[model samples]
Target: MNHWDKFLAPYKQAVEELKIKLKGMRGQFELDSSHSPIEFVTGRVKPIASILDKASQKGIALDQLEEMQDIAGLRMMCQFVDDIHTVVNLLRNRNDFEIVEERDYISHKKTSGYRSYHVVIRYPVQTIHGEKKILAEIQIRTLAMNFWATIEHSLNYKYKGMFPADIHMRLKRAAEAAFRLDEEMSLIRGEIQEAQAFFTRKKELKQEEKN
Candidate 1:
C-alpha cells in the first residue's frame, strides 16, 4: 500500500461506518412511519490532491493536515429548514460521537451566500491496534440550499473562485432564490410531513399483507 493509501484507510472506514449509522436514522423514522428530518446522507474522504490543495491554500503545514476536520466529511440533506436543526439536535444527542464545534452558516451565512449547519465531531473507530479517535465534519442543509451550493461550487471550480462580476452577481441572486424556496417549503412542511407519514404507513401495511 502507498503512504497516502495507508494514511487514508482509517478515514475511509470512518466514512463508511458513519454513512451506515446516519442512514440507519432515516430507516428508523421510516419504520416508525414518522417524518425523517434527513432526506438523504452522503459522505466522502477527501482525495489526496484536494487535501494537498486545501493545505496549500490555507497555509497549513502538510504534517498538520491531519487536524483538518473535513478530511472525512458527511452531508445530511434535509427536506425543510427546520429539519436542519432537528438533525443537528439528533447528532448532539448521540452517544457514539462527541460534537466539538458547530458553525451556523445557515443563520450567519457566508459572504458567498452559502448556508449550512456544520458540526465537527470526534468519533471512535475500532482498528486492529486499538480504538482511534478521528475528526469528521457533518454538514446539514436543506435540499434547496444544497442545490445552490453544488452549482456554486462547480462554478467556483471553473472560475478558480474569481468569477467575472456578472456571474458572481447572478450566483448571489440564485442563492437568495434558493433560500426563498426553502422558506416556502417550510411553510407547508406540516402538510408534506403528514402526507409522507401516511404513505409510509400504507406501504408498511402492504408489506405486512404480502408476507
Candidate 2:
C-alpha cells in the first residue's frame, strides 16, 4: 500500500468525523462561512513521505511519521486575517483541545514566503467503546492566502520551484502584493455587504409601499 493508504485506510471514517468536528469547532468561533468545508487532504502524504525517505537516506530516522495518522492536519479558510485570530482564540478556550503549539505564520511567513495561522490541538473524542485523544492541526488563513497558496503551488509545480530568476522575482512580488490587497479587499467586502443590505432594505420598503 502507498504511504497515505497505509496510514489513512483504517481511519477513513475517523478522518471525516474529525472534519465534521473541526467545522463545528470553527463555527463555535463565529468564523464559520457557507463556503468553508473541512477539506480532505489525505492523498498529500505521498510527497511528504518521499521527502522523509530522502531524509532517511541522509541518515535521519523518520519512521515514526510514516505510521502517524492523528497528525491532525486541517486548513480553515477565513474571510479575513482577523478571523484567523478569532478562530485561534476559540480553540484556546476549550478543555477538550489541549494546545500543543501555536505558530503565527501570518506574521512570520514561511521561508518560502507562505502565510497562515497554525494551531496544534489535542481533543478527546469518544469511540465505540471509549474516549481517545486526537491530534488536529488547524491552519486558519484568509481567502487571499488560500488564493496565493494555490497559485504559488501551481507555479511551484509548473517550474518545480526553479523558474527563471525573473519569474521567481515576479512571483514573490505578486505574493507580497496579494498580502496588501487582501486587507484592502476585506474592507471593500464590508462596504459591499453593507450596500447590499441597504438595497435589500429599500426593496423591502418599496414592496411595502405597493401593498
Candidate 3:
C-alpha cells in the first residue's frame, strides 16, 4: 500500500525538526526599540512531496516540478534589515548546521519581482533512536519585502503566471520602498535600543534604591 513511504518519513522528520528550530530561532529576531517594540513573524510553507511522484506519473520532469514548488516555504519577516542579516549570520556561525547554499535575493531580485534572502542548510537533529540531517530552506526578509512578495505571488498564482503591466509596476515600486524603509528602520532601531537600555538601567537603579 505504501509504495514510497520511506522517503516521506525522512522528509517529514526533516520538516518537523526545522519547525522546532524555527520556534527557538524566533527570539533571535526580537530587539528592544526606544520608539516601538520590534517583533518578527515566522511562517512555514510545506508542499506535499507526494505531488512530485504524481507529477512524474503524469509524464512531468523533476525540473518542472521544482518550478511548481510554490509551497513548502518558510518566511521570517523581520522589522529591520539588520535583523535579517543578523539571523543569516547567526545561521552561518552555527557549528551544528551546515549551509548548503545561500541566495541573496534581496540584492539580486528575480525578474518576476521576488525578493528574499534564501539559505539552504542541513541541520543534524538527534532523536531518541538516531541522528538525521534535515535539509531545509530559510528565507529572511523585512516586513515590507514580505508584503510586496506576498501580493505579487498571489497575483501570479491567480493569473496562472500572467501578470498585468500595472501589477508589475506596483511590485517594483513596492520593492524599492521596502528597501528604503528597511534602511530607515535599521537606523531608528539602533537609536531606540540605546535609549531602551538607558531606561532599563534607570529603572534598575530606582529598584535598588527602594531595596
Candidate 4:
C-alpha cells in the first residue's frame, strides 16, 4: 500500500496541476467575453486495480508501468468538433509540458466507434527529492462525441469488451448520430454563442442591480 501510494503521488499531482491550468484557459476566455473552445475539464489518476488490469492485458511488467501513457488522464470537452481542433492547437502551444505523441481517434475512430483526440504528454512534477517526469494523456472531444463515448465505455465494462451483435450495431449507429449532432450544432455555433453572450450580460446586469 505504501509503495503504491508513493508511486501514484506524482501522477496525482500532475493531474491536479494540469486540471487547474486547463480550466484556467477557459476562465481566460470567459474573462475576455469570448467563446472558449473548452467547455469543461475533468481529470483523474487511474485506480490501482485498473492500472494492474491494463498492465496485465498489455503484457507490461510492473517496473515498466511508466510506459502506460494514461496512468493520469485529463479530458477537455468542447461544444463543437471545430473547437476540439482549437483546443488541441492550444495544447500544442503550451510550454508547461512536452507533447510526446498524439492519436487522432476522431479522424480514424476505433473499431468500437470511439472518437476523440488524444495527446500524450510528458509532464514534470517537482517532488521533494527532485523533478519526476510522468506520462499523462489528454483527450479532447465535442460534447456529442463525449456522450456517445461515455455510453460506449460503460457498455465495454458491462460486456467485458465482448458486446452482443445487436448492441454493437446500435452503438455504431449512435456514434454516427452523435457526429451528425455535432455537425448540426457547428452550423449554428454563431447563433448559440450570441444567445449565450446575451444571457450572460443580462445576468450580470441583474447582479449589478442586487449590488
- Which candidate comes out best when scored by TM-score? 4
lDDT string for model 3 (103-143, tens) is 99877888765778998877665667687666667788877
By lDDT, who's the top model here?
4
TM-score of each: 0.95, 0.67, 0.68, 0.98
Q: Candidates' lDDT values, in order?
A: 0.92, 0.64, 0.66, 0.95
Encode model 2's per-residue lDDT on 27-113: one tens digit a residue: 543353232222222212234555464556556556655334335456777666766776677668866558888889888987666
Flag regions of model 1 displaced more than 4 Å: 205-211
lDDT of 3 at 159: 80
Spell out the clash pairs found in candidate 1: none
Better of 1 and 3 by lDDT: 1
Residue-wise lDDT of candidate 4 within 93-180, one digit each (tens)?
9999999999999889998789999999999999999999999999999888999999998999999999999999999999999989
The segments of candidate 2 whose C-alpha lies over 4 angstroms from its true place after superposition are 2-6, 9-14, 25-62, 66-71, 125-134, 158-160, 193-211
Q: Judging by lDDT, tell me the better candidate of 2 and 3.
A: 3
RMSD of 2: 5.8
The candidates, ranked best first by lDDT, are 4, 1, 3, 2
- Per-residue lDDT, model 1, residue 57, is 91
How many clashes in each structure?
0, 1, 5, 0
Question: Candidate order by TM-score, highest to lowest?
Answer: 4, 1, 3, 2
